[model samples]
Target: RPAKKELIRSGIVRTAGRILSSAASTPAAAEKTMALLEKLSTCTEGRAAIGEDGECVREMVRRLMKCSGAATAHGISALWSVCCLARDAGAQAAAEEANGLTKVLLVMQSDCSEYTRRMCVELVKILRVKSTTSNLSPYHSRTTHITPY
Candidate 1:
């Protein structure tokens, strides 16, 4: 029997949560989580359901980065993957720069997890390079660039 439309709609959040939990245990699942987060970040309607300012997305990384031992290592690596996407999008103005990256890095740098610290350093390095080129080109300089966001 086909599930009721309402039941299917109600199941979406649970399904996403399951995906996130599984991400912690498997590399393939973690990649899927990153992809799903990226899609959710782009969907205005979906984003609203999660929270204003994509807080849910941020929390996913936060949860992973805060885990202990081996789990923390994988979580931090997963977070680095997510942030790389955000950083790239931000450089092109395709994503909002509301200090999400900055805040996470601050926490990661002080994180008990060595992997988190390393990922934080890597993110900073990438951001430095991206920032250096962020304002280049005639359109950007002229303030007439129609940013994707």
Candidate 2:
């Protein structure tokens, strides 16, 4: 008799993607999604999976701009994970295209938690390093100036 093959269900990344897709309109749902994102940030495969979804990355950046407290901190952690894991130019380009740099800067100046502010600072440094290495300007071409918080 042939050995039975194990069935695989949707992975954490897939579930997180679904949660993030619906999180925009609901605050409770956003909180849950951010928690998942924070957990995902601890693993390289999870980070890569999140980065592969352009919509997810855009939504995370949007959350960074709008969400407060733990949600904002989770968004920063998730973005940091993506930046650390993403070796491709497309990932960096997608982040820049989504106006992530300016949003992150804004978060830095906001009265968010100290952890959130530190994460934003780290994210800004990562983006600057990536931009310099890629030979692109630190700010995206479309982002002329970042408004003060």
Winning candidate number (TM-score): 2
> Model 2: residues >4 Å from true position, as ranges?
1-11, 85-89, 129-149
Per-residue CA lDDT of model 1 for 1-149, tens digit only, reads 13333333464434654665554545455455544543543443433433322433444554443344444454444445544534434222211233334544555655456656777666555544444333321223334356798
lDDT of each: 0.45, 0.66
Q: Candidate 1: give the clashing pairs.
A: none
lDDT of 2: 0.66
Deviation in Å, model 2, residue 125 alpha carbon: 2.5
List ranges where model 1 is wrong by over 4 Å. 1-14, 17-56, 61-74, 85-98, 127-149
Tell me the tens digit of each residue's lDDT in model 2 across 1-149.
01111111235555555666673457667767877776765655566666777667777777765655677778877787777545535555666667777878888887778877777766776666555444445445555478999
What TM-score, computed on C-alpha atoms, does each candidate reach?
0.34, 0.69
lDDT of 1: 0.45
